[model samples]
Every structure is written in C-alpha cells, then in structure tokens.
Target: MTTLFSTMPSAVAPAPAADQAVQDSSPSLPEMLIAWSARDEALTARSARLPGVAYWLREVAAARTEHERALVRVVNQHGWPSVDLVGDEAATAALRILLHGQDHAFLLRCRDLIAAAVEDGACSQVHLAYVVDWCLVRLAQPQLYATAINPALGRPYPVADPDGLDTRRNEMCLPPLAQELARHQTRRLAS
Candidate 1:
C-alpha cells in the first residue's frame, strides 16, 4: 500500500540558493535536461525485475528528487515553461522529473505551466494529465487521469470516476487503462 508520495524521496534537501556560476562553456539547459532524465531512465530500465529491484527504484527515486531540486532551483530563477527550455526533449524531461516529484505544490505549478505550454504547442498535452494525477495522488485522493502509479503495488493509484476513465485518458491522449495495464504486464514479463 505504499503510495508514491510516501515512498519517494528518502530526503530531498532544497537546492542551495546560489552555486558556482554557470560557466560560459557549460552545457546548455537542454543538454542538461536530457542527461538528467537519461541517467534516471537508464537506471530504471536496467533495474527492471531484478532481485532488489525495489531497492534500485527507491535509490533512483531519491537521486531523481535531488535532480528535481536542482531543476527547481534553475527554473525558479527563470520560470517553469522556461524560455531556456528549448525543444520538446528538454520540456519532456522537466515534465518527467516533475511527474515523479514529491512536492505537490511544485507539481501543480508545473501542471499549470505545462498545460499552457501544450496550448502554445511547446509541450505535450499528455503531460498535463499526468502532473494533475500526480497532484491528486499526493493528496491521497483518487487521480482523474490514472497516471499516478504506486510502484510498490506495481499499479496505478486509485482512479476517480472509473466508468469515465477511458474517456478522460483519451481526451488527454493517453492509452486506455486496460492497454496501459497490459503494457505494464508485458514489461514485467519481459523484465
């Protein structure tokens, strides 16, 4: 019964207010974004279904949270849906980091920003549903979009309005719950 909110982030300290100035030669935000997300994805993909996979996932989650803390610091300096967040890859990375986030407030902020980004054709509309669902799950309420998964349970968190789930998922451009469940099963089997 470990909820995502309860299980994530063994501890995520707020990013320090100031750090070494970005070297003019430093990698751009888009590159940084891709690297950050790729690091986590590689870890998760590699750990799939191995013994102590949960341990690996938790480790990844904790490390990812620290990354998010850095993201927050960077974005806060500019803004969410940042002008510097050029390209879909960078934007999508931001969304993925926020999706696994423990901070409900930040998730909501990113949710709204992402929705606006979607309307502006800068971000995927699908991300809006997920950030919203993450917020709901963090509150211990049923998620509307069925995007928040409880990794411990290997299932989505409780979904509200079950009868209309597919409709909502479709509107957000997500696959049907059944389809997603099947996909999850396949991933587990393949793992």
Candidate 2:
C-alpha cells in the first residue's frame, strides 16, 4: 500500500557523465511520454498476440519517463499536499498510461507484485530494485538496470534510466534503445 507520501529512499545523484548521457541526444520528456502513450495503445491492440507479461511490459515501456516528470510536476505544483493527491487513481492512471498501460488487470498485477514484495520484507530500496529487474525483463533494457541502481545501496532501486528509454528515436522493436543502452553500459563498466 505505498502511496505517494510513502517514504521513497533517497534518489542517487546521477554522475555528470550519466547526466550527460541523459541530457544529451534525447527527445524532449513530453515527446518521450507521448510516444510511450502511443506504444501502450499499440500494445493493447496487439494484446491478443502477446503474453500477459508482455502486455504488462508494453505498458511499462510506455510509461517510464513520464513517471519521473509527474513526480517533479506534483512537487512543483502542490508541494506537500501533492503527496496526498499524487497516489489518487486518476493521477496513477495518467502516469501509468505513460509508462505501463490503462488495463485494470495489469494495474492490479502491479499492485499485487508490490504488495507481495513488501510482505517478503523487501524495503522500498530493495523493492525498487526488484521493480527495475521486472521492468528490464519486460522492457528488454537488459544491462540498463546495472548502470541505474548503485550496488552499494544493498538493494537496487526500481528507477529506470531515462538515457536508454527513447521510444520515438527507434521506429520498431527495441533495436536502437537496446544498442544505445548496451553502449552506455559498456562505457559505465569500462569506467
């Protein structure tokens, strides 16, 4: 039952290089968010051909960027009161439509996964790591998770790396983002 007010662990400061990786050579956040929305609709139309997990994944790919923007928006717009307002279904739906999907069943599955993780004594930090893994598997981001979550934190956080998740730059299934993320991971590992 994590709400917007739930204490999220401290966000790791991005390294300047990682910041450059993010800030350089990407579409505007709004553009990425809108593209994600379109991707979700496309997935929904193709749901019958995709696995439940894959459908679930199409939604995650759609929404990852906007989730961050929405958080920034909530804080900038309403401050503390925004926490109370942020977790509302409508707000969640808007964000999910950007990252995941609008399907109620898919949202329920996400809720269940989060609840199960908490019941397993996974703190928000660890739980987020699990989410990153989940998203990586679904989003097919591969090594992006390793670069995004610092291992020193005991458990990784669930945050996705925006540097790698550009839906528009690529015309079809995952090659561009995958190649870009792989290159980014190689650089991170070499460093």
lDDT of 1 by residue, 1-191 (tens): 57765656633233322233333324566666666677667666656645576866776776677767867765666566433354677777777767766777777877787777777866776878888888888888999988877767778999999999999999989999989988887876776
| The best candidate in terms of lDDT | 1
lDDT of 1: 0.71
What stretches of model 1 exceed 4 Å from their correct place? 1-27, 45-62, 81-84
Model 2 stretches astray by more than 4 angstroms: 1-27, 49-94, 98-191
What lDDT tens digits, residue by residue, belong to model 2 across residues 84-118?
23233333333444234333434344435444444
